[model samples]
Target: MTSFAPDSIVLNRKLPLWYQVSQSLRASILGRSPQDSLRLPTEEQLAGHYGVSVLTMRQALKELEDEGLITRHRRRGTFIEPSAQRGAPVRLLGSVDAIVAQQSGMTTELLDYGTVAVPSGLAGHFPQHAEVATYHRLRSEEKTGEPTNHARNYVRPDLAERIDPADLIRWPMTKVLRDVVGASISRITDTVEARLADPETARLLQVPLLSPILHYTGVTYDEEGQALDVAVIHYRGDRFSFTVTLDAH
Candidate 1:
């Protein structure tokens, strides 16, 4: 119970402090070294880190437990839940590689694939010649037999044409980019939003209508910073989570 938390955190008045504390701890657990079994700082240590009392830290830990992020034993310290043992920490640096390089044994199932018009607002994300030479893919994943992400991806026409649609099912997008287009990825930018799944999207993800989900849209750029592709993915809220680390300076 005397161990201090790993980092210092700042809280804003915009949201509940306990929730923010839970989120910070959740990120730490998910971003932990995969080789090590999940363990946590004791409540007293966490209280010291956040400059809060043991009771406040306990309330924050309770939030994580409710989210299936942690479990406590009577004599032993809190441990991360075993069922949620996914290692795919989506770091912004070397993103797709980080996402694909994981021990969770993620397999893809392609649902739909074909050329499509680039959506209107995405003009800046594509070159002028790419009026319609884009492709979209809808696929789901089997992560240890649990359906995890209902992903939708898009590739620039040239990149899309370089590989067979069938290959999309067998390979991760990073592989296709390397073997097919052979372009050096320079940057990735994305936005995450929450929405209620509609009937069709629900059917795709196998979740119920109106269930909460995370929707992501992003653009990838090549070494020259030229936009290479655009992607949209929907993750099953119950099975997937996104974590990002921030700095004050």
Candidate 2:
């Protein structure tokens, strides 16, 4: 059996043991090089390394198998799937920086852009302007070519004027606001909900109509508490996951 460092994965009693183990295993599998073993250590070895029960370790392995990252065999052993794709689920931990950090190396495609009267539903997000610049965008994994999210962004008129369409295609909206428009972002408020995809969203994301999706609405604000931009992203439910961290204070 291949040997593994016992201290490689540190467990947080506060979180689910199986989840922690699975995440660590996933990272290891995804980070492996060609020279690394294609097969994983036995469940008993992994359980001993992580100081978890065999049942908990099996649960962790099951999670990877469900993600198509690994396959288990009764006669042989557990091996990483050859067709596994890059960019495992997007993990969000209650911060804009964290979100941006996770999106590194992804490719962006700007589908459409135009200026129009701000929708009444988004009026509160841009109270000072009746009209705003809008963009329709889709981002996907560069390696696997799998669609991750479909997003529509509305920018304040002033900031939007300073932004270049090229920049929107090259960088994240928040990055464009900060680097191109020179807007100071003080905070970001994200509200997430579960909803079924509409026809347009289903078409763009390549999913069946009415398929469950994660609806994310994020409002970016300046130090003065004025909203500068609003982003609505429809994430494929199976392709993305959010990890939320909370403190009791």
Candidate 3:
């Protein structure tokens, strides 16, 4: 009656049996298997299925519950949290989708995508005024539809004017800029800081006023050493973290 392979290895030398079993279950859940949402089998069922003791199965499930993978209720069974549905992070340099992929059950929706005149302060960042264009987008995540980020991008007007908003829903903005607009991205300069979410941003991102938010500003350049776009993104602090590596040259 069990869906899992009976002969599956339940333990390894490098990890404890409980950890090994928890990892196996985590992988299954992240894979979006139908069993993910269902109440996991009881400890007795799991022990028999994995050919392990009931104590071992309980330890494994406990570890998973602590990691937010499974939720256990009294007189109820363990169920996978919706947040555990997202598989894993897909790295895309300086992109909104990359941020969303870090959390489970999160997706991006492109709202208000279009070209606009470059702002006065921002015009100084570009070489030519005529070359600059602007794109505004609101990114939200979760099946319940909650906003996670609000972003505005300024690109070369010549480049921005060529993109269709509909295409962005299928592909990330960077892909659209590269493949559709044929802009060869070469380098990126990015900076991140903590700031308070304004009222508008709070409402859009579904965060509280004065909530700490991570603000990222990046300038992307083309292969010809031309500035292609400047992107300003704000991410919810509660749900996001940034990591980078450095080398001694």
Candidate maximizing TM-score: 2
Query: What lDDT would each prediction earn against the true structure?
Result: 0.64, 0.79, 0.65
TM-scores for all predictions: 0.59, 0.67, 0.60
Runs in model 1 deviating more than 4 A are: 1-96, 102-104, 130-144, 246-249
Q: Compute the lDDT of residue 160 as modeled in candidate 2.
A: 84
Per-residue lDDT over 207-247 for candidate 3, one digit per residue giving the tens place of the 0 to 100 score:
88999998888777788877777889888877666655232
Instruction: Give the Å shift of residue 159 in candidate 1.
Output: 1.6
Order of models, best TM-score first = 2, 3, 1
Better of 2 and 3 by TM-score: 2
Candidates in order: C-alpha RMSD to true structure: 9.0, 7.3, 9.3
lDDT comparison, 2 vs 3, better candidate: 2
User: Model 2 compared with the native: what TM-score?
Assistant: 0.67
lDDT of 1 at 167: 70
How well is each residue in 24-111 modelled by candidate 1, as lDDT tens digits?
A: 6665565344454566777887888877778878888997787676898887999877554453333332235343333124556667
